[model samples]
Every structure is written in C-alpha cells, then in structure tokens.
Target: MPLSFYGLLEASLLMLNGIAVLNRERFLKKVFSFSSLSHIKFQLIFTRFFSVPLIAINILVILFKLLVG
Candidate 1:
C-alpha cells in the first residue's frame, strides 16, 4: 500500500473522531438507528477510545514508512 492511502484513512478516522466528539446527537440521529440515546452515547464513547489509538498507530506507520523509504 502507498502512503497516500494511509493518509486518506487517517483523514477518515479524523473525520469520524470529529463526528463522534463534536456532533454526537446530529450524527447519531441520522446515521445509527439505535433505540436509545444511552446506547448511542455508549457506542460513541467506545469508538472514541479506539479511534485515538488508531490515529496514533497510523501516525507511527506513516513515520516508519518515511523512514524506511
């Protein structure tokens, strides 16, 4: 895979992070068909935990690729 694809994936994850952090209600209402607000919030919180680490890992990968190249 190329660095560009990683960049795009990082961008996507950042966008998801923004949506999860900034516009919880609006995004959740339109995107997920959850029966309860609590459930949606829980999912958001859960996703938040993973997304941060993913972003960090992506940054590390990008750096590693640059170094290797």
Candidate 2:
C-alpha cells in the first residue's frame, strides 16, 4: 500500500536473493557436480551489481523520511 512498505519488501527480497546467489555453490553441488566456480562467481557479482543500488536507495528513502517528515 505505502511506498515505504514496498521499499522494505523490495530490499528484503534483494537481500534474500543476494544470500541465495552467494550460497548457490552449496545448493547446486548436489545437482551439478561439474558446475564451474567461475559461473557461481559471476552470479554473485551480477547480483551485487543490482542489489547495492536498490539497498542504497531504500536506505536513502528511510533517512529522507526521518529527516524531512
């Protein structure tokens, strides 16, 4: 409903997805015994590319509300 609620939800999802991407090696080891470490590394790098900006925006929004509201 509110922008703040959506921002929290998006930040949470980004955090969870970042965790999943970072730990994918452990989870995929069973299913793909031959998976390359480089692939997992790439996934982690790519996830961070998007996650950082979104999380930063969320933090900025919270701070803005607190200071200006």
Q: Which one wins on lDDT?
A: 1
lDDT of 1 by residue, 1-69 (tens): 567986797678767657657665666667767679777677867786877787787688679879977
Best by TM-score: 1
TM-score of 2: 0.35
The C-alpha local distance difference test score for the whole of candidate 2 amounts to 0.68
List clash counts for every candidate, in order. 0, 0
- Candidate 1, superposed: residue stretches over 4 Å from native: 1-22, 65-69
Query: Which residue pairs overlap in candidate 2's backbone?
Result: none
Q: What's the lDDT for residue 27 in model 1?
A: 69
lDDT of 2 by residue, 1-69 (tens): 467976687678667656655555566555545548766776667677877876676687678879977
lDDT of 1: 0.73
All candidates' TM-scores?
Answer: 0.44, 0.35
